[model samples]
Target chain A: MATLKDVAAKSGVTVTTVSRVLNNRGYISEETRDKVYLAMKELNYQPNEIARSLSKQKSNNIGIIVPHIEHPYFARLIGYLEREAVKKNYKIILCNSHAKFEKEIDYLEMFQSHRVAGIILCSRSVDIGKFVSLNIPVVSIERPVDVGTTSVECDNYQGGILAAKHLIARGCRHLVHFSGIENEAMPADARSKGFIKVCEDNNILHKEVESKADDYLNMEYHSLIESVLKENPEVDGIFASSDLIAAQVIQVARKMNIQVPDQLKIVGFDDVSIASLVSPTITTIHQPIKEMAQEAINCLIKCTEDSVVPSRIQLPVSLIKRETT
Target chain B: MATLKDVAAKSGVTVTTVSRVLNNRGYISEETRDKVYLAMKELNYQPNEIARSLSKQKSNNIGIIVPHIEHPYFARLIGYLEREAVKKNYKIILCNSHAKFEKEIDYLEMFQSHRVAGIILCSRSVDIGKFVSLNIPVVSIERPVDVGTTSVECDNYQGGILAAKHLIARGCRHLVHFSGIENEAMPADARSKGFIKVCEDNNILHKEVESKADDYLNMEYHSLIESVLKENPEVDGIFASSDLIAAQVIQVARKMNIQVPDQLKIVGFDDVSIASLVSPTITTIHQPIKEMAQEAINCLIKCTEDSVVPSRIQLPVSLIKRETT
Candidate 1:
């Protein structure tokens, strides 16, 4: 139960100097900082971060809301975001909204009460209007929130274009693009739009099959993929919106006795680890997850500093060729 | 800019009543609580959680330190932990230490300063001595820390036995168990011990191949698995330490033209999503991740309440039969 005054007395410094060292604010000599730390260690003094945050009116915490952490894409994104946040000495308060709007709102209220420096929204279940009145800086990843909220997303449209062009270049005649849930108005929906435009411009026979919300929630698409392949035997190429779906396609193709890269070519997006771990490693669109995460943190910090950052930041994506192509 | 006094005045209540409503402590009528909330909403008053925590000397946060968030096992564990935490109105301060001791220590100090109610240690890199002087409740997951620390873990030893017995029951002779890093006193190492014991009792020829730390961090076990399979062609049954390694084994076997379950029956540990997602779905030992997570949180909470709880909690595991076996 040692107080700040006790540490200052033990370190032979003023209380203000001890507080400055603890806050890491005003510049102090390296020797003085070392003395304070040594005294704290010897006295077993634990500074109250809550009191410090209350005095500063800001906490070194960034609220992160994601739909699901078990999903490979979100898992990778969260990992990269944590790494980037740690570099900036910011901790993340994780909230798994599970794509539930009520849960998202509950977490938002908690973040506000806790006075987090910023919020990084990875779940798109909540409406953009919910954040309109939020005093905290909000940064949405992959999903654009609103005109005032900053968003960091890879070029989903260009990723779709690259996947379609790659499949066509590999001599695919009939192609199918497996999209996410229909009518969601997500930023990722642009991938489907880009795919359709490319197919129409190339004058190639193509079809778009949308996955349901259940498929996403359960991370199970084998049955849907099996049916799609059975009904469309003529389809020789597929562009899946996620690597998880692409992996499922590969599994279904293996069961159907359809030879990949011989009778069919496939491309996946978000080049997560599964894209390469699966056999006949998937050719996928790399979304620059690390860079996107860094940018999201940067945008949130900048917004916290009262700096004007661009509302929309679209990083580039690249097509990674593997055995699937 | 709104204060508690303002909210109390607008609600036609005393400041004490408003404080009680905000803290949900003293008994208050539902109508009066609603009035306080309405007044706060009208005034856009955000109650400062930091100040409240300072007064209470506690925080509704559980600090969680994990090796890697992107790893499937840890990802699923974190998801379940978050769900369990949310149920109890507690938030998680996520720290991905990446199994770095220094980083873990840094996060531990931060957790202490922040006065986290408890800490859930998922990373096993730090020594048990580190938690000896920690004033907060420390619950270790899977790995036992010390006599004072509560640990929640699935029956890893029994899981190893189950996998071996299942493989042997499927008419396999030569067996190989792929273990984690050597010389690490992890709870998972019990799997290797159990596998060896069962093999020895059954008079089955068995070999153990240890995966290096690099194989784990990179999640790349293709070359190691390929080499082992190539060198030990006589090995007809394999028990992998994790589903990730099992998936890689499948990929390597495919490359070597080895038909699974016919030429080589494989069983993996940790029934994560990837187990079923991969073709020739892995037959793994199912760890009750949800139950374990709940138990860990329950233990931490019980400790916080100064209740006597068991030091070690070992949950049951089961064998999941799939195409691999």
Candidate 2:
């Protein structure tokens, strides 16, 4: 039941002085140090584990920043990261940016203040310069930063190509690709690029629908798909950027009386659980989420051990054929 | 670019003494303190935030424990809790219990060592006594603890009754209620209690299928539902404890050639995003997840301020009738 204040009062010193003795910090004279120790013994004070990391100028905690854990992609990734961190007796300090620029900045500053051993960022609106200046080991997931910064991502371009090829193989003449909101320079932009390149090479007609950045949590995918379908009524196939968007496409198509596979074949990316949960079992490009998450942690561990780290680690993606295609 | 060691070396004192000066902890002679301060100013050392919290014996952080963040229900709840915690400038240290008892205890001990201001437990396999003994203010979500413990949960009994009433109102004669795994002492058992009471009140034929607690994350709903349906082919109604279960029922029913709403009516609890995402749109009891999360945070803050929190705060649940019912 004894507290730091109780020990302070018993030892004839300020709580700060007692804390200093307990932390083995500050210029505590041998006499004062002995007195503080006697008071702690008499009070049965438990000097907590926090002081170990503080004196060492490091911690066994990894700061993980994501857009939101509620998103399936992020949740699954966090699960894997947690698995790895737990193995090393490292705790996770999780921050949800909630797609806000200010929040991400605040978290970055907080992580720095906490002196977390490392940080894994899946930020959407971060200032790259501020992040690079932190001087902590960082392994970004999906979102690639500048050179010398490590990042782990799936082969998004190959995913796009596989999607396009699958849809085309299913005898689709016209195509529409839904790209979730992205930075002009993000690696995910590569998904649409590959789709466009493949379509262009084959001389197949296609169009790309880019979602606004803010459209993720409050997705207007239904309206977006509805309008695109109305405008491109002749479109026979869709290569959606994500499975959730593809599921939305399926819903809109159902309402529009456009039969999947029979009349409007569709392929989705990121074969998340929802891909199979949906009735038609979405045909998707499966990006090895668990593998990518492991790679990110591995890269972070390597960086944490030293500044040397591979700039990029991209995993392969494969196609999962289902009823939708 | 200067390190703590550098500052200590320049100040002609041990790093512990310099750290003590930086943390304002322990006794330091005026001259020694001034020397450490001058060295810090020279090195431009940024006194980290972690040490400030350590000296204060408190932190602006909450430890959040859940069965698994990848589970939709937990993910959504965590998202709402994160939003509330961030508003108070408190960081969240997240842990997924992964349905393990030891992991829950390990996390609890870790949270104690870190001296978190509070904890919000959505644990499935925790010892209530162990949690209560930590002397930390805790707000348990869904899983109720002993009397005088703070907790926030939906009106589960009402949720069950609503499901039963909806099914009966839709002219369902032969009924079945799927009860998720529950400890006999848990308040969530009230859900099945209400369901059975409603069915008995209506003189309707019904059976309860209890799911094992271990079957949650790796759900065996498909095989379980298949056997139940095979044995009770005339079952025309179902009140599932969670939307995931109801989704499973829909999938099973489809394969069994049973038509939703036309031949069988189903109602589910915890109207998570998946309730609407699934085709046939599950009719579910909406548990007001966001409001519940806010209430949990409010209760924790109250308890942390002055151990005077209410024992229990229950939110209302409503039926969202979609295509399934």
Over the stretch A1-325, how does candidate 1's per-residue lDDT look in tens digits?
A: 7899999999999999999998788899999999999999999898888898998898999999998889999999999999999999899999998877888888998998899999999997466554556668899998787678998999999998999999999999899999988767666689988888989999999999988877888899999999989999999999999999999999899899999979989999999999988888899999999999999999899998889899999999999999889
Displacement of residue B174 (Cα, Å) in model 1 is 1.6
lDDT of 2 by residue, B139-256 (tens): 8899886665688889999988888989999999999988867564444588988888899999999999887766777754788888999999999999888888888898888788
Candidate 1: list runs displaced more than 4 Å.
A24-34, A125-134, B25-31, B128-134
How many clashes in each candidate? Answer: 0, 0
Model 2 clash pairs? none
Calculate DockQ per candidate and list them.
0.81, 0.47
Q: What is each model's TM-score for chain A?
A: 0.95, 0.84
Looking at model 1 chain A, which ten-residue stretch has the lowest summed lDDT? A125-134
Estimated TM-score for each candidate? 0.96, 0.86
**lDDT, candidate 2, residue B55?**
79
Per-prediction TM-score, chain B alone? 0.96, 0.84
Question: iRMS for all predictions?
Answer: 1.1, 1.8
Return the interface RMSD of model 2: 1.8
